[model samples]
Target chain A: MRLISLTAIAAITAFPLFAHADDRIEDALEARHGYMTMLAINMGTLAGMAKGEIEYDEAAASTAGANIEALGNYAVSDLFIEGTANGEVDDSDALPAIWENPDDFVQKFADLGEAAAGAGEAVKGGQANVGPVVQKLGGTCKVCHDDYRKKD
Target chain B: MAEDQARRVRIWDPALRAFHWLLALLVVANWLLGKFGPNIMTLHFWLGYSIVALLAFRLIWGIIGPESARFSSLFHHPRSVTGYLRDMVKREPSHWPGHNPLGALAVIAMLLVLIWQVGTGLIADPEDFVNVGPLANKVGSDIATKADAWHALGADLILIFVLMHIAAILFYRIWKNEDLIRPMLTGWKWVRRR
Candidate 1:
């Protein structure tokens, strides 16, 4: 009975993301940008705390880190819908390389999701501990962008 | 001293020579850092800043440094530049105490292109919003994008100018038996005194 109730709660929480997993979602370019912006915001908060630009607050760190973990694992395929790459659409920074090398693109996020999960947990430690993990999370953001994002 | 050794003149000064080699090393190192190790932003930015410092010194040196390092030495009249090019094609090695006319043009182009490269780098950013240059936040994202394009183009231009510069040195070394590289190091080149 207890295990069944725990599974039901987990399913209820995850159902929303799964429901919106439509591959042909509209305004995907904007959607993806919005998603990335959110990640960046949370990332900026953690980065600020890590760089001591913002005072270290444990609760804030934990929230931002967990937010990154959840966002990183969110279904990304729909957000990268076909024909939304730069030049194909207006103001798109999404490089054609993303579509050309879809496997590598998919793999990068998969790895980032895993890394974000670890970073999310590692950052739960006090002030001194968050810096390195924040850097690691930033690296995950960079490695993919370094390859897949439009440079200019 | 040997007859040819006696012909050696103090054309390049010590400061200019050191500046040449140090700038060369730093440019190569920084270029490699940009091309191969984009992830190494801290080191790359630090080296670039070092290049900017060296360039600043060079600018002052060009103004008031030795005759060899002066801006006056670099700008040959149009006729002289054309004549220099004409002589080179005829395999006539016209020797100057400082940069030869063709080399001077190459130097000017190189310095300009390098300046553009580093200048654009100040505001350059990938659209991905990575933690980047000092002026990344100062400019709008569109401007940063434009600068990034120029930055990449500038890098290629730098490489081409650098290659041409080296090729010119090698051409002099083998064909004309002129050791341009050594003078940059030793501050003296064996040239006809009269």
Candidate 2:
């Protein structure tokens, strides 16, 4: 009877740890999605003008480039915490290869930050300048996703 | 003369030989560019279109081609394929006027797989919204994602089939002492007089 009670107590305490871990993953993914959404919105602005879908406005181009450059430098380690890859979290598109090859994954993001910084400086000139910058920045996305992200 | 029992005959059409070498060069280029040269995506895109064109041409030509080049020439009875395999295991070779059974399998399988690779590649979207297939805009995001996965898988399948093909060619060269590649190159092979 005493052993049974002890086991119950241990289970009760450990349950919270599991729950906390789950919440941490959930929290990280939520933050990641929010961050990604912000990134897409800013990237969209630059891409639109670059593609001539939206008429080029110098002010909009400047703001979007600055935002992307800043977000590229944002500390993303928390969001990519181990055990938060796609198989572990159903909704996450982060592949296990990301955690396995952590350095390469992180370096890709760093490369993006560097390109974004250059792009931020370059787009200040005009729409013609924006097109080439967008192309350079866009190449980074495909290359990084080629290794780290799940299909799609 | 003993040599006159069989003679080199023009069998594979000039069109077929051209298709064979051109597709081979383009496929190798496409694989290299697609795998290693991500920065040169325009070249990759153009090569991919060329491959699609070759496949489209092959599909029609497979029907109306010469007797040796026609798809009908590739069809062996099921028992014949197995019998050929049984003989192959015993280190014996049977000369077919056109493709040997295993060669036929390799050719048809490669065609289907390459066709599938281009089909999916045409519609896939990686979702960065910047890098996408030419036809990506025609499909919903969900469908595009599905095709993207298939496209990736198709790349792997192509590699496997190509390796298998090379292995088969080597097997013929080293084990069977058959110069299967020569016919494709020169559009002629030594065959028994019909």
Candidate 3:
């Protein structure tokens, strides 16, 4: 009777495990899709400024800058979720080499995201030192892409 | 009857040849400048912009200029390029009126990659520390980041290929008695008389 009860308990516990599997896909999709939206908004606002449709001001610039900072978080969160789920989506721009060199890739992204966030803060402070902020973010992008992006 | 004849050939146009060599020199100078001092950054940026403009003009010219300048004429089948490579390895490289197969591919690849680098550079912002690509504001931070990565990689690749190209030319000159560089300078090649 004890063995029968234990086996029944195991079956019950496994039920939620199967249910969580479905949620993982939904979460992965959300994370990647969210980033895509963030990227679009970031570009749109910046382009508007460049075209003179939106005048540059501290308030407007800070909002754009903050958005840029948040962009990095999306990358980190999505990468983590996508990695854990290991979904069948191979169309991701991320190279397979990323998983192989997980430590380096993760570190690079973290460093890059930090730099980007720093730039956002700098922009928020209305810091005249936009050049430094730009450099930091640019450096991160260059380093990561050199190793990750496909050459074709 | 016995007769002797000499044939003179003209290949690269004056404008194109001049641009080619000058751009080569400027790219090297800019690379060195960046390595040596920050003072040259402004000049480097301007030179990069100039290269972009030159590439733009060349793209236009490729469609509308002389036959040799067209992309349609430049790119070749993989088989032909492989055959050229074989010939090159055998120390019997052939010369064409325009770019030879291997050289043509290299030229196109370099130009395309350089264009990408410059385009990205225009909008790349160092977050206002040292430099921002001229048009970086036109793109989002994410796009700019992606571009920055490509730009840096492209720059390094170009440098490597530039060195390889020079080495090949020198090898041809020494081993096959070819004057590859002279034609670009003088726009003339002296082959067999016909």
Instruction: State which candidate, 1 or 2, has the greater lDDT.
Output: 2
Clashing pairs in 1: none
lDDT score, residue B155, model 2? 82
Local error of candidate 3 at B191, Å? 4.2
Comparing 1 and 2 on DockQ, the stronger one: 2
Output the worst ten-in-a-row residue range by lDDT, candidate 2 chain A. Answer: A118-127
Output DockQ, candidate 1: 0.22
A25-136 in candidate 3: lDDT tens per residue?
5566566656655644654454444434566455666676677677866556444454442235544455667777878988987885687675445654433444445445
Q: Which one is best on lDDT? A: 2
* Model 3 lDDT per residue over B54-105, tens place: 8887888899877767888788999999987877766543555677788888
lDDT of 1 at B10: 87
Candidate 1 lDDT tens digits, A1-152:
99999999999998878666532343687788889888888888887787677888878888888888999789799888887888877778889999999999999998778878856667776778887776667667778876787766
Worst 10 residues of 2 chain B by lDDT: B89-98
Task: Please give the distance, in angstroms, between residue B78's alpha carbon in candidate 3 and its true position after superposition.
Answer: 2.4
Task: Assess the local accuracy of residue A125 in candidate 2 as a C-alpha lDDT between 0 and 100.
Answer: 75
Off by over 4 Å in 1: A1-26, A125-127, B1-6, B127-131, B192-194
Per-residue lDDT of candidate 1, residues B1-194 (tens digit): 34323366889898888888888998999888887775536788888888888889989999989787899989999998888777775553445667877788888888888788778888886543344566866997778878877887888888888898889888887877667887788887766532
